[model samples]
Target chain A: EAGVTQSPTHLIKTRGQQATLRCSPISGHTSVYWYQQALGLGLQFLLWYDEGEERNRGNFPPRFSGRQFPNYSSELNVNALELEDSALYLCASSLVYEQYFGPGTRLTVT
Target chain B: EDQVTQSPEALRLQEGESSSLNCSYTVSGLRGLFWYRQDPGKGPEFLFTLYSAGEEKEKERLKATLTKKESFLHITAPKPEDSATYLCAVQAVFHAGKSTFGDGTTLTVKP
Candidate 1:
């Protein structure tokens, strides 16, 4: 089976702009999770989506939001992006316990 | 509130040398603990999952064990390819929807 896939392997956006990152879950997977790994920092949870519903989110601000489609694909949108938003955005897919991650999208905010 | 911490921010070892990385956690209602391997400029790859205390899992040269307060990833006769950051995360049984993760330990193995 194909693993989790993400689009735009690398992205560059200016400050105050809006950035959109996409994730397509593996076949037969229903849950998609978004995480951000800042430079020299650990992975921080962003959002969780299951069956096209927003399930849970982390302590991040409301500017970081996302949605899951019926097909189990997800899109993470960051409005008013700041320089700190430059990080590797990862997406994982899971059915019950273990989560399989994608290659990740490297976002650079200038 | 749940918290996770890892010891030895970074470690360097020689090929064939064995060592262990620690992941200490404090959370209510332990559900499961997960181990992952992450390489530079890449995403984390799933390694193993432990459900309860005293549980153990192994793959290749790596073995993961879980206890009430901590988890350990032991590398037996590691290789240079095993050099990567190892991450540990835990989720509460009541709230498996989300998880708490440690900062992770970076391991570098030299030939």
Candidate 2:
């Protein structure tokens, strides 16, 4: 079975612009999570979606939002992207306890 | 709040050297503790998941053990290919499916 897959691989946007990253979870997985890994800053949880519902979120600002699709795929949207938003955005899908991560999309804000 | 801390920010060892990385965590109720290996510019590869204290799992040359407050990833006779960052995360029962991850330990196995 294929692991989680992410789209765009990399994204570039100017400050104040909006960016969107997509992720497709493994088959049979229902929980999708988003994380941001900045340089020096460890992986920080952004959002969690289960069965197409927003389950939980992290301490990130309101500009960070996402939604899970019916098929378990997810999209993370960052509004008014700031230079500090330049980081690797990772997506993971879990069946129960363990989570499998995607390659992640590297977002760069200029 | 759930939190995770990994020690020895970075480690370097000989090709045949054996060492263990540590992960300490604090949570309301630990649902599970996870270990993952990540290569540069790539996604993390699942290594092991320990659900409770005293639980142990092994794969190839890597063995993972969990305690009530921490987890250990023991690498036996590690090879250069084992060089990568090891990440530790924990899921809390109160948070449902959410997980908190540590900064990770960067390991370099010299050949």
Candidate 3:
């Protein structure tokens, strides 16, 4: 089966700009999760979406937000991006317990 | 709060050498513990999931075992291709959909 897939392998944006990253979950999966991995750091949970509803979010600021569509795809939007926002953003889809990840989108903010 | 901690930030092993990576976690209610392998600049690849203590799962040269407070990924007779960062994550029963991940253990196997 095809695993989770993300678009825009790499994205570059300047500070104060907005960036959008997209993810498509595996077939038959309804839960999509977003995470950020900064260099030398662990994965920080960003948001969780199930059945097109936002279930939970991490400690990130309000400027970091996202939504899940009816088809179980998700989009992460970072408004007023900062240099600190530069990191690898990962998307995951869960069937039950185990989550399958997609090749992350690398966002570089200058 | 749910938290996951992985130890021995890095490890170097010669081909055929065996070792183990540790993941310690604390959560309100344990739902499942997952192990994943991640290559540089790539996403995590799921390996195994342990739902309860004393659970064990194996694939190829990797064996994952779970305990009450921690889990271990044992690599036996590893190859150079096994080199990558191994990540551990835990989902709390209450949280349902969210998981907390560890910083991960970087393993380097040399021929």
Candidate 4:
């Protein structure tokens, strides 16, 4: 079976713009999670979507949001992006316990 | 609040060296502890998951053991390819779908 897959391995956006990152979960996976790995910030949870509903969210601002589709794919959207938004956005999918991660999308805000 | 702390922010070892990394956690109830390896420009790759204290798992030259309040990743005989950042995370029963991750320990293995 294919592992988690992410689109546009790298992305570049200007300040105040918007960015979108996509993720396709593995077959039979129902939960999709989004995380941001910023410099010296460690890995910060952004959002969690399960069964196409927003199950839970992190402490990030409203400008950071995401959604999961019927097919178990997810999209992470960053609005009003700031230079601090530059980081590697990771997507993971799991059933309940273990989470498998994708290659991640490297977002660079200029 | 649930928290995960990893020790020795960095480590260096020669090939065939044996060492271990530590992960200490504070959670109301630990549902699972996860270990992952991440390269410089890629996302993390799952290594192992320990459910309860005294549980252990091994693969290749790596062995992961969990205790009541912490976990240890032991590398029997490491290689240069093992050089990467090892991250530890914990899922708390009360947190539901969220996880707390440590800053990670950067390991460097030289030939």
- DockQ of every candidate structure: 0.75, 0.85, 0.88, 0.83
Once superposed on the true structure, which residue ranges of model 3 sit more than 4 Å away at CA?
A: none
Model 4 lDDT tens row, A27-96: 9999999999997768998898999999888999999988899999999999999999999999999987
For candidate 2, the per-residue lDDT at B34 reads: 93
Candidate 4 residue lDDT tens string, B15-105:
9999999999999988999999999988899999999999999999999999999999999889999999999999989887887899999
lDDT of 1 by residue, B33-74 (tens): 999999999889999999989999999999999999999999
lDDT of 2 by residue, B1-111 (tens): 898999989999999999999999999988889999999988888999899999999999999999999999999999999999999999999987778899999999999
How does residue B41 of candidate 4 score in lDDT?
A: 81
The ten-residue window of minimal lDDT in model 1 chain A covers A39-48
lDDT of 1 by residue, A32-87 (tens): 99999999888888898998999888999999999998889999999999999999
Tens-digit lDDT string for candidate 3 (A16-107): 99999999999999999999999989999999999999999899999999999999999999999999999999999987878899999999
Lowest-lDDT window of 10 residues in candidate 1 chain B?
B91-100
Tell me the native contact fraction for each prediction. 0.60, 0.84, 0.87, 0.73
Per-candidate clash tally: 0, 0, 0, 0
Query: Cα deviation in Å at residue A94, candidate 4?
Result: 0.4
2 or 3, greater by lDDT: 3
Q: Which candidate number has the best lDDT?
A: 3
Indicate the DockQ of the complex predicted as candidate 3.
0.88
Candidate 3 lDDT at A3 equals 88
- Candidate 2 interface RMSD to the true structure: 0.9
